[model samples]
Target: MKFGVVVFPGSNCDQDMHDALQNDLNKEVQMLWHKDKDLSNFTTDDCIVLPGGFSYGDYLRCGAIARFSPMMQSVIEFANKGGKVLGVCNGFQILCESHLLPGVLMMNAHRQFVCKNAFIKSADGTPLKIPVAHGDGRFQADEKLLDELQVNNQIIYTYCDKNGNITPEANPNGAARNIAGIRNKAGNVFGMMPHPERATSSLLGNVDGVEVFKFLGLN
Candidate 1:
């Protein structure tokens, strides 16, 4: 699969995401500047990746303003047509702000940007590299939407301890329903607050995050 990684002015994870998808997953991946409107001029087999970073200096919010980038306008159109989209960390924030996915990435309950090694229990049988990093990653959505998500099997991953119990402390950034990540109703689009690209190497201590990329056809 060919993956497109979007780069905003302040996106720090663009290179990391690009390299991970290219070298780690051994997939054809390209970097698109935020100002680029003609992604069609690049690769065709489509999969979109939104990487982590303090886009626009995290000024208004994690992804609040970055959603307006020219590339995003086409990203929304692509996703509506059943094209797959994966948003990690700040990318997840952009999805929420654009309503491409439900919920919001609010401030951590402690009102601070959180950065640390973190583990998220997978609900699916597939294996993956666990996620790490983030400060304003608490996930929030309406109760009705939450119920719908569960009923549809859209709640792909949840934050939990080694035992897999959803607890307040286990839920980093205090994401609502301990939702570490989720998929759209179509299951084509996925957004998570954790950085899967960062977890692809055992030398990094864990390879739990690689499954997400594999799931999207990278591996």
Candidate 2:
């Protein structure tokens, strides 16, 4: 499948995502500028990616301003039509700000930026080591909404240990339920704090993250 990696003004990881898709995954991928309002070239079957970075220098809030980018309107429309949209790190913040996903990414409970390799486990019991870099990585929402997500099986990834154990010590940003990633009720939109692209290559020290792309049926 083709991939469109969004490039916001301060998006530092766009090229990394592009390279991973094109070189590692051998997929058709292009950089989509944030200011561009058109997404006519991308079909519903194609995947749109909002890569991680400090968009707008993290001025107002993480992803608060980037959500207003001209291209986001089209991204929203595309996702509403059952298109696949993946948001990584700051991109995940953008998705939450845009209401494409429930809950919000608040400041890390520890009041510090966290950058490290974290072990995360999918609901299906698959575990992977992915890198997470962010300051506002905590996820917060109403208790009812959290309950709804659990009942719907929308929670996709949670911080875990090598043994696939979800424990408080494994929680890097103090996210509720140790959530590292989640999908929308429809499952077409996904948002995650970890940088899967960076971990896809063995040259980077690990290829555990390749499982995420393969989960999308792209690998």
Q: Which candidate is the best by lDDT?
A: 2
What shift in Å separates residue 103 of candidate 2 from its native position after superposition? 0.2
lDDT of 2 by residue, 139-203 (tens): 88889998998999999889999889999999999999999888899888999999999987878
Number of the top candidate by TM-score?
Answer: 2
lDDT of 1 by residue, 10-45 (tens): 788889888777877777887888887766743334
TM match of model 2 to true structure: 0.97
| lDDT by candidate, in order shown | 0.80, 0.91
Alpha-carbon deviation at 72 in model 2, angstroms: 0.5
**lDDT score of residue 36 within candidate 1:** 76
Work out the TM-score per prediction.
0.92, 0.97
Error of 1 at 44 (Å): 7.5
Give the per-residue Cα lDDT of candidate 1 at 51: 88
